[model samples]
Target: MDEERILERERYQIEQIRQLELEELQVEEVDSDDSDDDSSSENNYRTSGGASASGEFTYDTSLVALHSYLGDVEDTHNRLAFLDGGAVLKLPMFYLEGVVLFPEATLPLRVVQPHFIAAVEQAMTQVEAPYTIGVVRLYRDSPDYRRPPRFAIIGTTAEIRKYCRLEDGSVNVLTRGQQRFRLRRCWIDVEGATYGEVQIIREDSPLRTPREAVGRLAPLLNLRSNIFQKQPLYSPRACRLGDWDGNDSDAMSEESFESELSLHERGLHQSALFSSYHTIHEPTSSEDEKLDPDGEVHQGSSRLDNLLGPLREYNTGRDSAKSALSGNSGNLSFKRMKADKCALDRLREVPRAFWPNWVYHMHDSYTLAQKAADRWKHIVKAPSMDGFVMKPDLLSFHIASKIPVSESLRQELLEIDGISYRLRREIELLESFDRVRCKTCENLIARRSDMLVMSSDGPLGAYVNAHGYVHEVMTLHKANGLAVIGDPVKEHSWFPGYAWSIAECATCGSQMGWLFTATKKKLKPRSFWGIRSSQVADDTR
Candidate 1:
C-alpha cells in the first residue's frame, strides 16, 4: 500500500481514541470549579493583554508580519458541514487569541505568533496562504492528561480573509470561521504529530442583532471596555479597528436581557462590568491593502519571488536529487554562498525572525546565501556548488526562538564543502532535527491534520507536513504546489491530501495543501505524502 493509505489507517486509530477522551472530559467537567486545576489542561493562561482601560494592547509581536495572503472562502459545501456540527473551538489552550469562525462571518486578528511570523514571511517572500491552522485548548495541566493529545479539539475552521505584516513586525489576520470541528484523534509522525480527523458539528445561525444591542459598534465598544477588563475580551486597539454593532453576542435576548440590564445599560449600556464579545468580506480596498502593505510591493513581485527562490535552490540541488532518484552516489559537488532579502519596502508585518530582531541580518544572510547559490551557477553553472548544501549551518540555526543549537556545528556545516565522509557526518548532524513545527510562528507551520502543509522557508526542510502525521516522504522530481500533491488519483487515495476537497487561500496564495503542485521543480525533488484530514473518524486506540 502507498504511504498515504498507511497514514490513513494510523489516523483512523487516533480518531477512536479522541472520541472517548472528549466524551470523558465533558462528563468530568460537569461540576468542576478548580481554577488552577484544569486551567493548565491544554494551554490556558492568556497574556496580560486583557481589555485595557485606555485601549492598550501590546503583542510582543516584534514577530508580526504584514503581508497579503491568498485564501479561499469556505465555500457552501464546507459551510454546510459546520452548521451540522455546531462547532466552537478554544485552542492552544495555554491561552487562545483565537475566535469562532461563524459561517458568512469574517474576523480580523492581529497575530504575533512564532509560527505565524514565519508563515507571514513565507507569504510575502514565498507567496503562500489560505492554509489551515490547528488550534487546541490549553490543556497542559489537566487531570485526564493521558487521553490522547489533539490539536483539533473544538477547532475553528478558518480562512484568511485579510493578513498584514505590520510595520512593527506584527501580523494582522482577517479570518473567517467557516465551521467548528471536534477532535476524533490525532496521528503523530516520527517527525511530529498530525491531526487525525474532526467531526464538523456546528451549524451557524444568522448573526442576530438584538434591537437594544443595535448601536453603531462605537457604544458597544465602550461597554466592552468597562466589563471584561480582566477576562480575555477585546483590547482597545481591537475594539477601535473591529467594526461591531451592539449585542454581537446572541447568547442573550435584547428584550428581557436589555430590561434586566436597563439600569446597567443606562448611558453606558449601563450594563456594569460583566459582558461580552464578538468576517470576512474582502473588499477591493482591503484586498489592495493586504497585497501591498504600503503599496511598495505588488502581488506579482511576491509570487514571482516565491516561485523563483525555490527553483533557484533546486537548481543547485539538481544533481543530488537526480542522483538520488537514479541511485547514484558520489563525491557530490557543492557550493558555499549567501542570499539575503531586505525588506526593501517597509513591509510592516514582517516576522520577528526575519525582522532585524534576533540575529541582525539573518533574513538578509539567508536570502543572500540563497541568492549566492542561485547566481553562483547562473551565466556559467558552477560544478563545485551544485550538489553542495547552501548555508546548511545557517539553515539549521535556531530561527525558532532565536538561539542556535550549536554555533560550532552550524559553523562547521557552512564551511564544509562536498559530501565527503566528514561532510556526510556533519550533514547527518545537521539533518538530525528534521521535523519542522506544525505549530508555527517562525518560518514554520504548526502541526495539524493530513493534507495540510507548510513550505520550508526555514531549515530542516520547508514544506513540513502540518497535518501532524508521519509523512510518506515521496521523492518528487520538482518543486510543486499542493494541488498536485493532493490529487487522489496521483496518490491513488480516496481523499485529496487530507480534506475530501481543498481550496487555496486566495489572500496569501499559500498552496493550501491537496493533491496538486503547480510549483515547478527544476530537477530532482521530493514531497511529503499523507492522508486527507476530512476522512478521519474515531481512531480511538
Candidate 2:
C-alpha cells in the first residue's frame, strides 16, 4: 500500500507540473500581445511630462522584464473531512517568523530544506486530507539576546493549492489556510520532521442582528441573504473557510464538549447581573417605537431596570463590604481593573439572552461589522466586500489577514475566538492606525494616508523571493528614516514596472524594506516604498 501511494503521488505531481507549464505558456502569449499597446502609451506619457522634475527622472531603459509565477491556483475543493468529526488530528508542523495565517488566506511557500521537503512529501501521501500542514508562528518570548524560539499554541492548517518541483529538488508550493487548530503537543519524527497533535477549535456562532433590529439594518443587510443562497448557513461544527458538509451532532463525542462546558461556566454576561429578577416587560407593537433601540427584548421598557436598580446598588454595597474585609482599597481597585481587562479579552461563553436597557448598540455584531467594513473601504482597496459583510465571522478574518498591522496585532486577532469581539477590536485598530514605525528603533516610516494600493490583493501583500523567503510588505507613496543600498536591480522584481533597491533604517541601520522606482516613464508614482511588516511597528491599541 505504501509503495502504491508513493507512485500515485508522484504521478499526480507530474501531471500538475505539466498543467502549470501549459498555463505559463498561455500567460506569456497574452502578455506579449498587451506589451505592444503599452509601449505606445509609455512614449506618450514621457512626452507629456516634458522637462518637469519627475519627467527628468524617467529612464530611457525599458521596464523590468516580468517573470511568470508558476503553479498558482486556488484549491478550495479539498474539504477537511476530520474537522466535523471532533477528533484529535496529528499533522506535520511548519514554523515561520512574523506570520499568522487566517482561514481563507493564501500563503505561498518555497521548501528547500531537506527535512521540510520530506515533511511535504509525507503530507502528500497521507490517506486523509492529503497536502495539509499546520502553520504556526515561531517567535522569541522577549527581546533578550539569543532566546530560544517558541511556537504558538494556536495555528491554522494550510492545504497545498498548487506546486512545482524545480530541477534543484526544491518545491514552490501555493497553499491556502483552511481551518484553525490548537497545537496540543509537538514532536520530531525519526526523519527529523516536526509534527503536532492538534484539536480543531470550534468557534462560537457569530452574534447576529436580532429580529427587531433586522428592519433597522435593512440597508446594509439587503444584499446578504440572496448572495449567500448557494452557501450553507454557518454551522459551528462545519469546517471554516470552506463549503459546509452537513455534520450530524451524534458525531461529536462526550470529550468534545468538555472544553465548551468549562468555557460556559467562566463567562459573565450582562443578563447574569440580574438573572434572579423576573420582571422583564415585553413591549407590544404600540410600544415598540418607544423602545430603546440599543437594548435587547427583555430591556424593551424601563420597568425591568426600575425594579432592579436599587437591588443592584444594594448588592454592590454588600460586595464592597466583602472586599473591605479582605484588603486595602488601593490594591483591591488595581486587582479589579486587571480582572476586568482579562475578562474583556475572551469571548462571552454563555451568551446573554437579553441585555440591560443601558447597553449600547455598538456591541451588536451587525453594527460592528458595518462599521468595520466601512472603515476598511476607506483605508484599503480590494474586491467587493458585500459577501464579507454577510458573514460577520468571515469578515473579521478577511480584514485581520489583510490589515497592515504588526504581527503582534495580527496574532492577537487570530487568538480571538469570538466574532463580535474581533470586529470591535478591528474597528479600534482602524481608527488608531495612524503611523508606521520601525519595530526595532521606533523610527517613523510612513502615515496611514500615504498607503499606496499597488496589488489587487490590498495595500499589504505577501511576495516570495527567489531565496524562498516570503515577505509581507505594505506599499506607500512616501517614507522617511531610510537609506538605500546599492543600485536599483530590475531582475526578478515582484512588480514588473518597478526596479527595487535595498532600503535600511537611517538611524538604526537595520534593513527596513525596499524602495521601488519606476523603470518605465509611464508608471505612476514614479517611485514608491515597500516596507516589510516584520520590520515595522504600528499604532495598534
Candidate 3:
C-alpha cells in the first residue's frame, strides 16, 4: 500500500470512527506490530491490512489528545515501558521542541536538508506506506540558548500519519505516533540534525507492592506531613495526591487533575509536593523508618536487603507485593486507569529501605531531611511547574558543560567505581590550580555562610565549602617565629604538591568558584570549598 492510498483509507475511517465512538474505546492493552513476525496488522511493519478493501477501519483517540496524556503521566509508578522486537526506525533527530499528532489531520512537513531528505528517499522505497516515525521530546532554546539541549526518548509511536509534496523539492508529509519508543542510539548527520535508531514501546500495566506498605504510606501522607525527611516536597502527598480532586478520577476535561499532571514535566513539582507534605506531617524520624513484624531492628548490610527484608517474610508466597511494578508490565499497547491506581498505591507503601539509591546520594538529601525531620508544616499547596518557581537545588547543567576536565578525565569519571574517590581527585586538582587560589583562601572557616558544604554526603548536607576554598593560603594554622625554611613545597604550611582548581563558565570565561584540595593527612571532617568571583552567568539567574 502506498502512503497516499493508506491516507485516503484513513480519511474514510475517520468519518465512520466518529459515529462508532463509545464512552471509552478498547485500545489493545499494548499496540505492537513487529515486521519480523508474519507482517500482520497486529505488529510493527505490515505490507497491507490496516485498512479494509472498502476503506473502513476503526477510529481511535486523536493523536493530539494522546500526546497530551503522554506529557501528563505523573507518579513514576505509571510510566510507559520499553518495546522490544518491533519495527526498527532510522530518522534525523527531531529538532522541534516537541510535536503533537492530531488524529485525522495529515500534517505536511518539508524534508529539505540533505540527510533528512535521504531518510525520506529511503522510506519512499520501502514496501509499507510509511515505515515508522519516532516522535521524541526535546529541550532547546536555540536562538538565545542558556544551556545545552536535553533530549529524551519519550515520544509516541506513529505509523505513517500522512504524506504530500508541494511544488518545492521538500517532502510534505503527515506523521503520527503509533506507540512510544526509546532511542537506541543518537548521532549527528553530516549537516547536523541529530538522527538515531529507535525501538517502539508499549505501555505497561500495574506493578506489585505490599498491601501493608500502601496502608503505611497513604494516610501518613497527610498524618505527619512534615517529618518523613526521606521524602521531599515533590512527593505525591505534598502535591495533594492524598487529597486529589474527586472529579479528577474519570474527568476528561482540559483542566482535570490527571490531564494537568500528564501535561507538565513534573519532577521539579514533585520535588515541591514532597516539600509541602512535610509541612503538615510532624513525624519524629528524619529517615524513612522501617518496621519488622517481630519489632526487631533491620539494619541490613545493603539497601536492597533493608527494603525487601520485612516484606519478604510477610509476603512469603505468590500474593506478595505484586503492586510494586504494575507500571512496567507491558499492555496490549495501552494502559488502564485501574492499573495506574494500583501502581500509585504501591509507591505509598515502599519502605525507606527500598527507595532508589539516588535518593540517599542526592545533593539535596539533607535539606529534604531537615524539612521532614522538623515536621514543620507550611502551606499545603500543589504548586504546578507551569511557572517553574523554585531555585534548582543542585549545580545542574555543569555536568555536561566544559569544566577543567578533559575528555580522558571526563571518561575516568564515567568509568569510576567509587564515586567519592572520583570527586575527591577532581576537587584536589581544582583546588590546586593557579587561577583558583585568591586573597579569600585565608580565613575560610571565618567566612562560613558563603561557603558550600557536602556533609556525609548526608541527610542534611551538614558540611560547608568543602570543595572550592584556598585552604592553604588562609591562616588558621599557627605561624611559629621559626624562619628555618628549606624547599617552599615542604616548608609552606599552605602548599600541597599541586594548586587549587578554579571553576569558570564554559559559555563565557568568567570564574564561578575554586575547588580546594584535601589529602588523607589534610582530611578534617569540616573543611569546605568556596565560590570564587561571581562574574559568571548562571542560567538560574
Off by over 4 Å in 3: 1-92, 98-108, 124-130, 141-153, 188-194, 199-202, 206-541
Candidate 1 TM-score versus the reference: 0.19
lDDT of candidate 1 over 236-303, digit per residue (tens): 22223122333445333334333443332333432111122000111222121112222122334443
- The candidate maximizing TM-score is 2
TM-score of each: 0.19, 0.62, 0.25
lDDT of 2: 0.61
- State the displacement of the C-alpha of residue 125, model 2, in Å, after optimal TM-score superposition: 1.2
Error of 3 at 54 (Å): 42
Q: Report lDDT (CA) for all predictions.
A: 0.28, 0.61, 0.31
Instruction: Look at candidate 3 and tell me the lDDT of residue 488.
Output: 14
Model 3 has an lDDT value of 0.31
**CA deviation > 4 Å runs, candidate 2:** 1-82, 143-145, 209-360, 381-384
lDDT of 3 by residue, 1-541 (tens): 6957955764564443333322132211111342222323342322211111111212121321121111111111111232454657665444333222211212224456556565555554444323444544444434246778766544444344335443555554444334445578878766554567876543222112222122112222323323223333222333233322232232222233323343132333233223322322233444543324322223442432433333233323222234435544332222343443343345454332223334433323233323322221111111111121122111111121112222223323323322233333333333332221222222111121122222111111101122211111111111111111111111111112212334323223334333333222222211123232212111110
**Model 1 score (lDDT):** 0.28
Q: 508 in model 1: Cα distance from truth in Å?
A: 45
